[model samples]
Target: MRLLLIGPPGAGKGTQAVRLATHLSIRHISTGDLFREEIARGTELGRNADRHIRAGLLVPDEVTVGVIRERLARPDTEPGFLLDGFPRNPAQAAELDGILARTGSGLDAVLHLEVPDAEVISRIAGRRLCREDPGHIFHVDHDPPEVAGTCAFCGGELYQRDDDREATVRRRLEVYRGETAPVLDHYRGQGLVTTVSALGQVQEVLDRALTAIGRAGSTPRTP
Candidate 1:
């Protein structure tokens, strides 16, 4: 179940990645989480990435690819892994192919979660994250917390991330359009791209994703 999940900022790729990884019993490798971990530890890579991230710029491909290579070499990835957020452009996509080639492994499918730009803006603008755990996410309209401005899972304040701000999200969307969209074509050329709509309830989207992947000829592992 080696898969790459790609989508716009508010397409719910992160949530689906976690669920798909669990369903397939594969390692879930999220570049955003990886960057956060590195930055929290103040590693050299993190220090470098921090500058680009804070400036609302994409991290250099070399730095991003280095981190990914290290991660992909780990034992857990030997079986399979679900990759999210790393290959943001065609160059990184090609670099990923090179990295995997060294290990004689490659992606079975690249899932593109398609959502309209307007929907993306609406979703991201309403999204909030828990102070204690960013994983505890909620949307003001779609999935509000029991108490407004508070986390449902934990009694913590909920705040919108800077990246989720309307202006910032628009900028991010521009960057995605300029850089990341080509990666889809790169994978499509390999016949490894699967398109799925990102709008729907969580389970509904998951089912669509699963069906898409299954049609690609890969089945999730039994729990």
Candidate 2:
């Protein structure tokens, strides 16, 4: 099933996206990965996108749309794909519709993971990352490291990134609310949105998401 997954940063959308795509046997596509792939391959579009990114500016819609267009053209997407972090606003959503319309196809559903702003702040602000290895992430509440203010792996200093600071996280939440509200509203008008609570255990959320989408028995099921 062609699907769009939308949620705030701390809503565990990334984890759910991977699980849903795996269970459904579909590609899990995120714009950040796409951009990284492009930049790593040193393509012209990648260079242009990199320039904008280096300048701390949003990549132009045309560039972003082009990236998605090329990705969707791949043979792998023929079966299905779970999209994340694309079509960030209504304008991009319209562009996505045009792209799919050309091929006589469109999204089957848009899964929205709902999380309260207070919870979002708590979840993000407590995050700590290892300076030596960004992958070594720890949460003050959910998963603290063996030693406080340090990473279990590599013995690196664990620091809360500026992006994860309370103030910055709030700012990000505000931006998400302002931009994605209209996109969600637009999808609701088209009757393609499925709202799901993004709380509880990972397995539980995964089950809930699958059940919510599969109520129509539309998406393929894994054996």
Candidate 3:
């Protein structure tokens, strides 16, 4: 199924995207990963994005669109792909629409994982990471590693991200409310949005998401 997964930070969109992509046998295309790949390869688009990123400015929409276009053009995407972390605003959404139109394909569904702001704040604030691999996640209260200040896998130091600090979490939440929330309405109007509560165990939430999409009755199942 061609899908778009949207949610606030810490909402487990990344986790679900990985699982759903595997389940449905489709490529998982995350904008963040795309940018990282491009930058690592030092492509022209990557260089432009790096310039804006280093300046602490948002990468221009067209640059992002270019990366996405190239990704979607890949032959492996012919079956379908799951999109995460792109189309962050209405303009990007419109650009996506145009791109899909030109390619004669369109999204089948947009899954909006809804979680309360208070819960999101608490979850993010309690988050910790392994120093050796910052992406190795844990939660101080919810799911702490076996040893305090150390990674369970590699015994690396555990540290909290500055962005996961309470003060930074609030700012990120505010930005999501101001900028990302409106995209929900945009998809809603198109009758393509499936809202699923995202406040439960990760597997439970994924089940809920699958149920919601199944009920939508528009998504194709893998044969």
Candidate 4:
């Protein structure tokens, strides 16, 4: 499926994207992961994105769109892809439309994961990441490690990310409301938007997402 998954901080967009992509056999194309990969490689785009990311600001639309365009052009994405974290505002949404038009492709569904701001704050505040692998995530309340401040997967030190701090999470929510929320409206007008509660167990949420996508009338492509 060609999907765009939207959610505020702590809404588990990354986790859901990974799960959904695996189930549908589509590439999980996350802008956050793209930026991290670029930064880790020390590419020019990564250097530019790093500065904005460090300040808890959205990366510029041009740079973000450029990266996404390059990614979508790749052969692996021919099957389909689940997009996360790009098109943060109406302008970028329009840019995406234009990009897809040139390739005769467009989103099949846009899933908006809804979670209350208070819940988002609480979820993000307790979150921890492994120093060795950011993928090894834990929540102090919901998914704590066997030992305090340790990663269960890699035995790396686990610590809360700076962006996961309460204040930063609030800021991120503010940004989402002011910026990302409108992108939902942009797609809603196209009759391609689906709203799903992001609460409950991971598998439960994933099931809801799958059902929502199916109801939206886009069958997953056979792998």
Candidate 5:
């Protein structure tokens, strides 16, 4: 199914997107990941996005929309895709509609992960990461590394990101409330949104999301 995943920062939207996409054999597209890849490559788009991302601000609509269009046009996305961290507000949602309209396709569902602000703050504040490979994530209180201060994958030193700090996480959450909440309402008004509780274990939350979508007929179980 072509789906969008929307939630506040620390909402585990990325985790659910990855799990759901793998389970359904669909592509998972994340604008955050896209920006990171581009920035790593020092592409024009990446350079433009880097400054905003570093400051925990949303990338401008034009740049973000262009990147989403390019990703949706890829071959791997032909079957379907689980989109995470795009269409962050009403404006982006409208732009997404235009992109889909041009492609002669439309989104099947929007999975809205709902978690309380306190839970979100707790989850993010305890987060840690591998300095050498930021992709490797851990939680200091919940899921620490095998060896303290070391990554299980590359032996990289584990550290906390400035963006993941308490103050920064709070700022990100505030931005989500101000900017992304409207996107959720837009999808809800279209009757295409399924709200799933994202408060349990990662796997439990994933199951809840799948069940919610399956009941909505967005995902069909295969024999």
Candidate 6:
């Protein structure tokens, strides 16, 4: 399935993207990976993007769109692709429409993982990452480690990530809503949106997403 996955911060969108791409036998194309690939190759677009990113500013749409355009041209994308993290706003969404239209293809579904903003804040703010392995995570309430300030797996310091601070998370959520709402609206107009609750276990959420996608597929698209 050719799909666009949208979710706010702490919505578990990353995890679901991996699973959906695998299950559907499609290439998972994440914008972060696209940026890394460009930067690793020392492309001009990457250099520009690096400069802006280092300044804690959003990368210009031209550079990001250029990176995504190249990624979409790869051979693996011929089968299908699941796009994550691209098209953060309506303008990028329009750019994506143009890109795919040039190839005479369009997204079959736009999977929107829905979760309350308050819960999103709680989910992120409660997270603690291991000093040794940042991937080792524990939630203060849901999955706290044996010791309060230590990583159970690595016996390392467990500290809340700066981005996971409540204030930071709230700001991120605010930005997400402001940027992402219109993108959702754009797809909704095309009748491609498949909304699914992101609450509950991963498997349950995945099942809901699949069901939602299936239902969207059965509906006729607008011209």
Q: On TM-score, who's better, 1 or 2? A: 2
Candidate 4 structure quality by residue, lDDT tens digits, 1-223: 6889999988988899999999999999988889888899998889989999899887889889888888899999989899988788999999998888888778899999999999999999999999999999999998999999999988999999898999999998998999899999999988888999999999999999999998986554221
When summed lDDT is taken over every stretch of 10 residues in candidate 5, the lowest stretch is 214-223
> How do the residues 57-79 of candidate 2 rate in per-residue lDDT, one tens digit apiece?
99999999999999999999999
TM-score of 2: 0.93
Cα lDDT tens digits, model 1, 42-140, are: 989989989999999878898899889878988888889999997988999999999988776688888999999999999989999999998999999
Model 1 local distance difference test score: 0.90
Which of 2 and 3 is the better model by TM-score?
2
lDDT of candidates 1 onward, in order:
0.90, 0.90, 0.88, 0.90, 0.86, 0.91
> Where does model 1 exceed 4 Å of error?
39-47, 50-57, 128-140, 143-162, 218-223
Best of the two (4, 6) by TM-score: 6
Badly placed stretches (over 4 Å) of model 5 are: 37-47, 50-58, 128-140, 144-160, 218-223
What is candidate 6's TM-score against the reference? 0.95
The model with the greatest lDDT is 6
The positional error of residue 18 in candidate 1, measured at the CA in angstroms, is 0.3
lDDT computed for candidate 5: 0.86
Clashing pairs in 4: none
TM-score of each: 0.81, 0.93, 0.89, 0.82, 0.80, 0.95
Per residue, candidate 6 scores C-alpha lDDT tens digits across 1-223 of 6899999998999999999999999999998888777788999988988899899999989888999998899888999999999899999999999999998888899999999988998899999999999999999999999999899998999998788899999899889889877899999988888789999999999999989888978865543
Residue 178 C-alpha lDDT in model 1:
91
Colliding pairs, model 2: none
Off-target runs (Cα >4 Å) in candidate 2 are 216-223
lDDT by residue (tens digit), candidate 5, 16-104: 89999999999999887898888899888888888888898768999999889888888899899999888988998999988887877
